[model samples]
Target: MKNFIHTFHKKLQLLAAILILSGVLVSFTYEINTSPDPKKDKVLVGVLRYILKNGHYEPKDVNDDFSKAVYTKFIDEMDPVKRYFIKSDIEEFSQYKYKIDDQLKREDLSFYNLVMERFYQRLEESSTYYKEILAQPFDFEKKEQIKMNYDELDFAKNKNELIDSWRKQMKFNVLNRIQVQLEIEEDKVKEDSTYVKRDFATIEIEAREKTLENINDFYERITELDHTDWFSTFVNCMVEQFDPHTTYFAPRIKEQFDINISGKIEGIGARLQEKNDYTKIVELISGGPAWKQGDLEVGDIILKVAQKDEEPVDIVGMRLDDAIKLIKGKKGTEVILTVKKVDNSIQKITIVRDVVELEETFVKSSIAIKDGKKYGIINLPKFYIDFENPDGRNSGSDMEKEIEALKKENIEGLLIDLRNNGGGSLKTAIEIGGLFIDKGPIVQVKYRGNSPSVKKDTDSDMQWDGSLVILVNELSASASEILAAAMQDYKRAVIIGSNQTYGKGTVQNVIPLNKYYNYPDDLGAVKLTIQKFYRINGGSTQLEGVHSDIAMPDKYSYVEIGERDLKNPLAWDKIEKANYEEMDFYKNFDQVVNTSKERISNSEEFTKINEYAIWLKQAQENNSFSLNFEKYIEEEKEHQAEIDRFKDVFKHESNLEFQSPLKELDLVKKDSSLAAKREAWHKNLKKDIYIDEALKVLSELEPKNNKLLAKK
Candidate 1:
């Protein structure tokens, strides 16, 4: 057995206190040959606990109180929907809840092992519950409702109660599938008026069969998991108490994280979100396999996945991450997806997995004509940079080049679209922010022990000082927030978006765990929050992201989708303002914004968007659902009607046209994929209500004798 005992370089007094506090210095060692592999995991746990204790920016005391907190988090994470583990299970596990902290300090696995055994046993028992309930068709006439938010309900008292709970959940799924099947039949009858409709019992039986398949697939996958899997979950539950972003990634997870950072993923390249036991496609990376296939779409529910020549594996009710793993595979491999489309029609689509280039993530420029004059749009997806080679392709330098090209066209104004941009490199944010002003402090960084350092853009050259508008949304975060805040603070640009951006102010550095200790295999990595960034004006964008100057009514404006929605988020604060000059670039900015607001009030698109926002809020709060099939179908129709009321809002298109860069036009013309993507993007841009309002605001931003200064 090998043990890792890192030599501490702490002060004698601190070391003495740590020893006294811990009582006994216990070290865990892993044998060369072991089945459970507690030795390696114990080392990982030890390393993380030490780092949290000694090196974390805001370390917490690891005692009984912390242990209790971790226990709650683990239980919640293990079964978020409260599907498994009855009341007795909780009582059985209560003995080790407070002892977890002491056990962790001593490298003990008693608590973890006991919890794991109980959880697996409960899951095994619940498997039978689901199968038995699903085998029998649900009673459609029963007037009952299932509480969707399981947190509001207590655990089942006995096996019978647990079976009833699973029964209701299965009934809900069965009702939805039957409703969808009936809707399809109705549509076909509408087309032909002679199509035969299946009886209710037949539909019911098919739905039950599908439910059985989903449960069987779920349990089969669960059986594939090993000790490493559960250990990762437990350790992360412990680490996440410090902050939401600070996470402990297992070796496989760390690899995925690296893949994400590289902006390249070997898969179909579709972003998936789990809602109500179904995995729905949110976004497809342009030019990726799914995008190229053109059959897959956003809002498509992927119900089943199959590899080439293999039977389809049901993904319905499976965890989103697990479902994704089944869908994603090695490059050139084919995966078939059975999806239920938005219109309730089922279809099968096959796509070959490949390393998606994410071409759309790069800085893209287009010319927009509002009257006879041309305006420029620089849509920056992420502040990407090649950190290995600083001088390589990066947002800072690439944006400068894009501006120079736009200047050659003599654009009347410039609009930077940061919507859906979750942020990337910090250095690029400062550089991009510097492009507007001659030179200034862009942001401030506060470390644990060191004083706040002002990250300044020292370049004296200004790229574009013309009319500027920065577009953001609830998803716009970190670097996006920094750039928007800097521009807003300097009075250089009008920030417009949902009510605020995603308020993630903290900075993280991913440390490889193996680097700290010797290990034969990969030991994963720890992403630690070491610092928090602040605006040059001194306010931190922690929870309250930068408020838009012109608050636009968007879909997520009313939802709690920002960093504040996360657990253990850092608190917002302010530091000493950095020394910087504020240019009076938009003296009439307020007036222009007010006029736009008035127009927005009168505009159909804006009004409809606001209505949709209200509807979204109602939908989020409407958790409980009717288990009776008739009521459920009627409720779905009402929901669809409400959506239909606002359907025309998204279809509203501006008359303006977007132009491709002259140099790339020929290349784009030759590449069918690029041409198709550009066409699709231009179509969306025309339909963008926020962009329409942005353009209107730009037209209104006509300066009082060059108030839109051209700084030299």
Candidate 2:
């Protein structure tokens, strides 16, 4: 009895310790809010938060700043242009400005629900504003301007103020239409003296009708978006605070993302992006309907899309996915796009939708004889791989075969063009890097809570040992940087292009959240940034991609397209340099690089490129546009003249004929797409000044004996 009494105090202390730990654990766990949708979506919020907090490579604390960031991003996603929501609404939402992290920790979405509910109410109010304004015709003779860059403007003060903002915006939209219609009617008058031309009143009426139709489609599209669509915005807003590339893809959206990454789609293959409320073509899928037709071009603003025999639906100010839904359809169906060309001329282009296989994404090569020395140019669009099949066609293997074919042709030098390659499998990157360098470390990867590991090219046999040069652009990313940096580090290849690559070095793994829960339906997936990659020389590419060995002026040299411009991008870092050995680089590497830079400095084309880049930078900076029709027309003509002047600079064609890789002769004969795309590619190469300069650099890289044979 005496011994038991002595230990009673010890037992009491132990009990207190257990209770404190339990309370801490419970406090950190999430709790569901009272809203019906929150009750349903609480699981996603919890899972996404847990993954980001735990698995993310550079996780931020769930603190006041993070909560503030979420609030700001969520509001921006809802209304990017400040046309909706007043300053009062923002202040009201600020109550949860510091409490969002608390709500997230408690698994509550009271703030989200309140803000979104108010957003819908504002949406309803704004819909009336557009309709009321469009009912009356816009006065084109009025001298006014609309701020095209919404980021530079502040939100409205109240509902009436919001209506006035919408009035100006709607007036501007109608003015654009009236001006185009007036130009068309004027052109028709030139064709025939008696051609009955519509008057200004009729033109104005038509513009109003078009504007009303566009707004109607917009409202209808919003109606189609359910809770899932809204929730995606909230979820992504949370994840994106970690990094720009980190994202949360909802179920259907994930399917589309997978299709995009797979490099295949069953629709009219044209990539689109929203810039200043207009959907512009970012690029075209080669061998796809858009590329084959060649009517829709880069920088073309798609104003509307229509099915066969149906009235065109205006896509202006519409969300990207909604416009994509209208444009994408079953294979063999036709979709017509009403596009405003870069010259500000409007036209309709028809592209028959087809199953765009993205054959161009695969490694394609050609034999180019420059200075009489045979050189091989291999264009790798991306580091593509069939993840489902281990032995399937992948960049690494396809590249090996292409190199072998080029070697068989007795090529003396090689140009591995990775320009615009946004990267894929790390395994393929390693394998491809091995082709040039001997067995050595290619890249280093760092994960949270673990020592950085070195990924290597273990192959002892060398593949392409010739003098090499790699082409890159600002669009080149991830695995592309890995290969380029490795080659640069080993001095195995000369890197050229934009000032730097896209600077995306973080690695993401898309984990389907549904896999972690016992829930019945799909819960979508979280693209978690779990690791970062570094060059073998210890430099990370997080925000400073791989710097080019020979920096050249390109379109994006003065543009802010790199990762450093993105929101909350991960910080660049370094680790100990990985073990590697240098390859036998070109003996005259320094001489060649120096000569090339000197030539580019003196060339008229380079001068024009630099001038055009300056003009582009200025144009990007000036976002306010006049609503006056005459002034707008005058501005368009000025821009067209400026763009046309640069045409001659980019128009210098090289007399280089490229042949199919020797091993692909039979395949090229059998595959019409293969033959067609290569022919098209070779034709462009003939017109490529960059490739022409690259060839000249290759000539200088060759030794005297090699140069003499090349000269012959």
Candidate 3:
């Protein structure tokens, strides 16, 4: 069971084809404002309509069904929790539910204007309701419950009903805080017999005050968002019907995307997300200052950020963009963060900002020893490439280099891990796949109304002709899926892990609004899906990602995940197969798969993992909780017990030993941070049951050719 307060941060990385827009220019006028600009909105509608009909891989018909989807999505996006809008409000807005398509065609803003005005009025009124509710103390003795099953809930019938709903939600918040505080007090009393505990009434009042402060902070963030931001949401509701990945980025957001693509920012190199009222650290770029500092970690909450010798700015409920701006600065500068650690302890961490290099995103290799035989394990985080510079570093070259080093180590087999890779450059994927097999068609691409074009790896230099294994999960997508599909088709490698990889076969191109229009102000752009990918063997990975040769039970095994789970994802289809030769290297591939299946089934750890995944899904589906403090605490304790039982899933250690390649070892010595990171990685590898299973499989495989060993 997951806590509502400390949930994991999820990052969405798009796999796109960045192309230059040239040749044609459609004229348009632009306007900018903190409020809604009818002229600008009309222009955006016209441009998006033209692009969707012309450029999108598959465009939905602009009918009543489409209009209804947009209407529902826009309302849900505005008031997700059913807190702001009332039944009457929805009733009044339902008149235009089937007219949005007509309005879009006519460049009309009547429905949009009506909704925006009512939304603003309701938003202001909500502040008063929350303030009034918080001014009075809640009755904890009342035996009541709050149902957070938002989808099943109906809007409030009247103003009185809406106020009561807010009251219950506020009560729930305060109750959770009070329960936590009481637990801390009880723990203190257990440690020290003489420690006097505070009275329940005093603790209850304090919780109310704290909850009020948090609510105010939430409202402060709301105030920062203007009409333009809301309009962007409305636009996205329409665009997302085409596909999940296709989105409308506002001018400010587009600028940030450009900055990220260039990868030249100087910061602490930690990816963060706005988790409710706090900023949560999601990922730390390897070899970065934050990774080196060792104090910051994933799941840590940033409460405040302060520069060197400056007063700390409490960032709770702050806008993510604003929080990021404060965190980022020039290289060599120091930023101090007051963070709430995973253990609930607050501490200040100081990190000197530096250029977060693309070093960590490259390929990393390690040598594993099993039964006196050496094997190579390479972990590729993404299929990265420098788009602006041809000579800059990329994953393909780094992969080839790692393989050559591994070949020198006299490794008998090789394994590549692409577990959570979300994909990047398609060119890099093709190049890397070429290193595994002789020249062949790697993948097929098809644009709208065009025949499938094969993307071939013409190079015939097979880098490692040894036994090969690739590990993937539901998170491995796009370019990662391409390489895995190519290898599986050619029988070059055994794919293992989840049932299927992340099914992201579509290619998107960001079309800038200003590029096609004569606009005075930057009008942002739309990321339009223009192409689809197909395997060399004639299957599309659109929804049915590459099937694994040997499936394994994982934490996400039973969860709704991948492209198939997304709304309005392009359907899976097949095309004509590209001619290719399947390798004749490994012996009894079916027997190998059967052997692994038997082992996985008999293993206690794998059984426990599958059981835990089932239980976690059930827990996620449950959203009701008692407001009564006693029952609430009891429920929390039961959940915590279940969580504790599964802790060993990650804690179990293996006997296999892992070490860095010779060249990386030398580089590690010169960089202490890199050394520490590699040491931690090797330690984790020692505990990896999956890696242990992979090593066993690697040891059993028989290769037809020994060219790599012979060269060594």
Candidate 4:
């Protein structure tokens, strides 16, 4: 056994060396590019065709260079700085035409080497920057920090120490990855022992030896090697070749997407992410099991999770999915998590598993007042609501209720706040849009089908006939676009905020891999684009998202942060317009628009927005980024100073907090004034900015009409 172990170790070393050598060669050989290369195009097409055919999809024409074109287009859209590759890079990449099989054979080794080099580079860079960043007092004002840690170890501040740390970190990462892959593979083997028939004795012996060798190599490298900085260089080189979205999803990275999307999952109802070696709770969902227990809080690091009557399993450096699987069990099961609090105190807390739901993301309502006029505000955190489960509280229903409430209050206008709404259900969107207008077309959707289908506002009645406004930003997407487009087309509401919508009009269907392959049913699901949606007015909310009527300034102005900015995104096109009529009340839109422009131009808020827009534009143009510690600190301070300028002017309070608009209406004396107030309140109830201006215009028009009536 000892001899065999020695031999295995020797083989692994050889394999590792071969991988590193191949990766170095490949890195130097391939140059990233955008222009057409027939050879590269052919290779891309072949790979895509294979994926399509073998990957459970109908094979399209693989002969064409469509895949390469799509990839190039996608990359061009995503790279804000355009630093990944230049035209020269494309020209260089066009020279290579390697076979897929040959690439696959050395792919693992190449990837490992590339990653190792990248890791080392980042370690050195981070270490140098860390020392500089720590020299200054921590900037407490900025919400985010670029660097998390710094060290000033006098005795161990040498190249060896840095190398050792880097190696240790890499080994930890590699082991975690191997463990996760093994577990997934093992599950597959157990489900169908026939295909994965393993000789247990041989497997056990081989695995034990490999594990020991991995540990030994990791330890030896950390203690012995003179580490070189290579992370940034390697990552840039690799990512440049690959499409922007095709990133390395490390074992701990599963939670990153979860953080951005759902915020909370069923397991303990806590948000988790890897910070250094620890899986820390970024947030605890309110009213969840974790919050109910009152033991966990944001920034608490979870070290282990133990099942009832089982030994506590150390989860540090474990794959996020595996850890989550252990933590999350059947509802009603008890699981105890050993947690390290922010202050470094450790404690064990038992939490009962329950259906943990995120309530904070649900639609909320308020009222905004400007120039002594009330505007109903419906703040939708996300375009979300479970459609599969009928019992779920639909966002559409919630929005309808808010509209009704505003109507009851008799608001002068309404604003639908979808600033950070990252989209949810399409069904809910249709239902919500149905609340505004009488029976008409809401949005048209076209699949890879023969014809397009027009989804209409089929609801029996309208909730409010008042003026409407939609407040959107770059994050407003998918279902949010559906509602916004519907209102825009019908002229039921004026769209406000941001340059354009998120442009994610396409729909994706989650395809279960286990279902497709009749093998051991443990493989995960794949989300694939299945359909695209078009506005009632033929134009697609695709690459070019729906443009806003009244654009507002934002920090992300220059960042191109939208679905259209994503890699491999579909193109924008047009379809047949749906049947719909413009609202008669909004006929005098010219006068309203002019009045709004005049009013907003004089307002402090609008001036601030204009200033912010200019700042963002300037920031985008800034290409000289500093990696030097002192320079970075200076830049950060300058950035903060610029941000602070808007702090005073951005203060707009909710009118709902002061007094109900309903109560205020009761104080009006004269019948004509009371009637005018009612009209203004009704328009405000729709949360429409344009409508508010329109109401003011109407107020001015009313006296003239009264005089005309007296003359008659």
Candidate 5:
């Protein structure tokens, strides 16, 4: 479920701000005369005057040219594509611009008819082209086969064909989904209902009629679907548009926006992305049905979906919204998906839908020993915890359990592996940070027109008072930033890994607009940027993410990645600091820092990473590589040599048999051999220079208390 806000209220707020700034003695009034051309120039002037007086713009002149400039600017900002109106459409729209003198008014039927007619034509064309493509077997040989080469195609023909194809495919997909749902519902009624008032014939007839009605409803509502790709093209052709951020949400799209913001819904619990005409799996939630089944994997293509014991419906070329509806069902119902694997093999999987609890996203850990030293390795897949379900076990709680297990093992130091962690619950972040430090504010949230709220680590007990090191990369974000920032702020632990974190300091409010309003179908939701997070010292983790205390060589260089490269991202800012005491362990951090630097310089893994980085930089700059058969073979051989050089260090065993680390036979002897093997293995794992450095750092910083106890 998502929180819904009124769209009308949002608009009113803007309008109120404008009115306040104008300071008009009397309310300005003008009547818009209905005409074929509403005098676009006049409307442009009125809008510019209002904006200059009230909006952010402060114009020096108030003339017709100025009005045109404002109108042009609005058009450019609002619509980048000229698609909504071709030259003729623009000319048609310009006829009635004069009607904008007083209140904003337009001939609703005329404007709607113009847009609707164009949309219908596009739909019809899309339907026709889709049918033609469906008539032939889909070719899967080419990875980019579904891509539309618009530049190469005849403009008019291509546009019409593409539109028709899309429409037909969407219609077919919608019809198929309705039929499946109806059948599934019908079966449930037969099984659960006690009363047998109606015969099988009546039930069958009613289900058929219901399915038909659904199909008709979808067809009629096609106009409401604000497919942004189509609108983007339309707006681009119009002229100068506004910032790309400002976009209109169609009724259907509103539902999608809602689902996106909430992050949890009654679906298969899989992350999906649109690739050409297909919805590809970006990632599988660790404990979700897909992951549990072990059939569906990352990069797998969803081809179709089916109801239990029913014919599988092909979903290729179907809209993502429609596909999602088919997959999402009431909890405990089974939905089968037909998936095309990366290996070009196809399989059908049936999943019993359930509430996608966020706790499932976290991975817990224990300890591993090599020689006499205890190594605490907590493998965190993501920083996830479900705030909506307070009673549910969260990532923080799971981590606490792992720490308890490590404490029992008498671990000397800890390794918090945050590799590939995308982040999750903010609440869990604060709680986890509490485990490191005694007490203090963990993170701050700043919202529009509101004082910043400080989230503190209020927990009384510290889980681990020993040495700690956090592992991170470019992928770590949101809650990951929160935990890493807190640890750095308190000087409680050493931050090691990539140059910087993924700077996503803002928080979004997922408002479900449809939940507040009644409509034929789900209206969707909006994910609005309502708040930004700041560190305790006031420095924001915006474009500049948390910088690690000690930097090491990473496969991905700082030059190629991080938040600075992102567009339209919020800028970093600072605020007043809160009171806190720094940890004593970090007082001599410079000594530890210098020692690690010197060690890395002498490290073979670091040297290899530096070489690899140089090679990558050269390749990117040159952009010219040998394609000649002989040269290509030679280049490949050279690449193999680099791989071979690093392979010798790990002493990697190809036919290595699995052994239970839990076995208790001559533990010290078993540990000594494993430790020797790992040291040798470390030399080969050059690709992960950060991990190599982390291990070395841990060895140097090994708790003196544990060492002294062992000697005694």
Candidate 6:
């Protein structure tokens, strides 16, 4: 057994912590050796416990309360919809509710064993129930309602009750599909005078059959999960008690987490998912080798995979992860895939594997021209970076290049869209924020009991000092919050969008499990919350994230989707404010904000969005649907009518023209896929009401030409 002890250098500490903390812990690892291994699970539990208790920012006591929380989380996760386990099964499992804490200290697996064995039995029975229910016809005339809120529902009292629940759920599913099919038929008949539409009976039967296939495929995928996968879930349930961000990654999951943080992977760059007994291609990375080949496409099913000049191995009935192993290879290596095309034709497509950078994950800039003044819009998906390779492509460097390109275009203003960016590399956030201002403190970091350390922009150079506006939403978090907060604190940029960003202010560090224990099996690492983030203004973006300078109404405005909505998030606090000089570039920032507010108040589009937000909130709360076909269709018709009122939100187009930079124009023109993506992005920007308002705000500021300071 090789010991994998990962020691972080002093300079790489901040980078490593942010890379793991910013993103969600990814999927489970592929099991190469699929035999029952209880010993590995036991060791993992011990190692995970040790790491959390010692390394966590706020470690909870492993007492009765902790045990109860874990017990509930584990069971809820395993049977979220209350479809598998019954009331009696939960009753039997409740005995370990308090014993789990003691079991963890002793590295006991009794609770996990009992639950898994019961779960498997229940899973098998549920599969049988679904198959039986779907095999027969469903009565659409049945006057009943299925509660969509699964949390409020209870487990079945008996076998018969469970079967009844499955029947009702299955009927609801079939009814939805039938309604959709009927709509398609109605549209087809209107579009073509001679088009023959399917009858009610035919549509109902087809919907049931499709529902059966979907359920069967779902069960097939579920059956592929082994012990390691479930154990990871159980471990995470325990670890999450420390905080929501702290999670466990299985060995393969850890590898994937690294790939996500880096924003690039070496493979064919095609995302695959299992469909019953086949591997279905879901998406092709825009600039990947598979996309460049032009032979492969989405919806293609891989029947077999082969190495260069080698006989193809059938991949039918193979696990998705296993099939991925066969498809992915080193850069410049060839992998031949015998795929069934969407047109039902079979063809062998050979693609040379190469490092595929996910285009959307990196920083991409587009220029919007209005009144002959160019404005730059840089959308940063995440604070991505490759921790293992210091010289690898990162968001910091990419943003720098993008700013330079936009500067060459002589943009009058800039809009940095950090909305929905959940953050990644901490180093990149600092690097990117520095581009907007001269050397100053950007954010503050503090350990559990240590003095707050100020993280600053040591560089004296500024890449962009024009009229800047940051776009954020409730989904923007961590490094996104850091950058926006710094800009807001310095009064260098106008923060616009949601009322407040996603309040994830904690910092986490990934600790490899194999480092502490030399084991043959590749035990995954744990992302532990080791620190908290504080803005330069002293307020921590924990439960209360960076408040927007000009709040806008959107679909998610009334949603509880921030850190405060999450379980056991760290509390918000304040520290000593960092010493930084506020920029006076936008002297009338308040005037610009007031003008935008007035415009928004009078705009019909903003009024519609606000009304839609209220409607969405009501829709989310009303979680019951009628099982009766007539009643269901009636309810859906009302919803469709309400949705129609907001159609202009999606269809609204602005007069501003958007296009790629001069340097990217040639590259995009060469890569048709790239061109299509940019074109789509430009079209969306043209329809963005927020961008239109932002451009107006930019024009109002009329920043001086000498906002850029002299480089030291």
Best candidate according to lDDT: 3
lDDT of 2 by residue, 1-712 (tens): 3343234334544443332211111111112222345555888888888888888998999999999999988988888889879999999999999999999998988888888888877776666677667655455556788886777788888878888888888887877777777778989999988999875555665677677766776666677677887888888888899998688888888888844333233487767766546887765765678877877866678988899999888888787766777887988889989998654557899989988775666888899976676888998877888999887899999999988878778887888888767788898999999988668999999999798899988888878766788999888889999999998999888888877998999988889997777677788888888989999999998899988877778756786777898889999988889887666556788888998889989988888888877776776777788886667777877876876777665667778777777777798899987788778878888888888888777656754233323533
Best candidate, TM-score-wise?
2
Clashing pairs in 1: none
Tens-place lDDT per residue, model 6, 321-376, is 66777887899999998887543335679999987757756789999999987889
Q: Is candidate 2 or candidate 4 better by lDDT?
A: 2
Candidate 3 has a TM-score of 0.87
lDDT of 3 by residue, 95-195 (tens): 99999999999988777777877887787778778767766666555688899888789999999999999999989878876876777799999999899
How well does each candidate superpose onto the true structure, as a TM-score? Answer: 0.86, 0.88, 0.87, 0.53, 0.55, 0.78
Candidate 6 C-alpha error for residue 282, in Å: 15
Deviation from native of the Cα of residue 90 in model 3, angstroms = 0.5
Tell me the tens digit of each residue's lDDT in model 5 across 281-365: 7556655666555567555788878888886655654556666788888778888887865433345678888766554455544
lDDT of candidate 6 at residue 274, scale 0 to 100: 52
Q: 78, model 6: CA deviation in Å?
A: 1.9
RMSD per prediction, one decimal?
Answer: 13.4, 16.7, 10.0, 17.6, 17.6, 13.8
- The parts of candidate 5 lying over 4 Å away from their true place are 1-269, 275-282, 287-317, 322-363, 382-392, 512-524, 550-567, 591-692, 702-712
- Off-target runs (Cα >4 Å) in candidate 2 are 1-37, 190-194, 255-265, 273-283, 293-301, 307-310, 330-334, 339-350, 665-674, 703-712
Q: What stretches of model 1 exceed 4 Å from their correct place?
A: 1-35, 190-194, 259-267, 272-313, 317-322, 325-355, 389-391, 519-521, 665-673, 702-712
Clash list (residue pairs), candidate 3: none
Residue 473 CA displacement from its true place in model 3, Å = 1.6
C-alpha-based local distance difference test score of model 6: 0.79
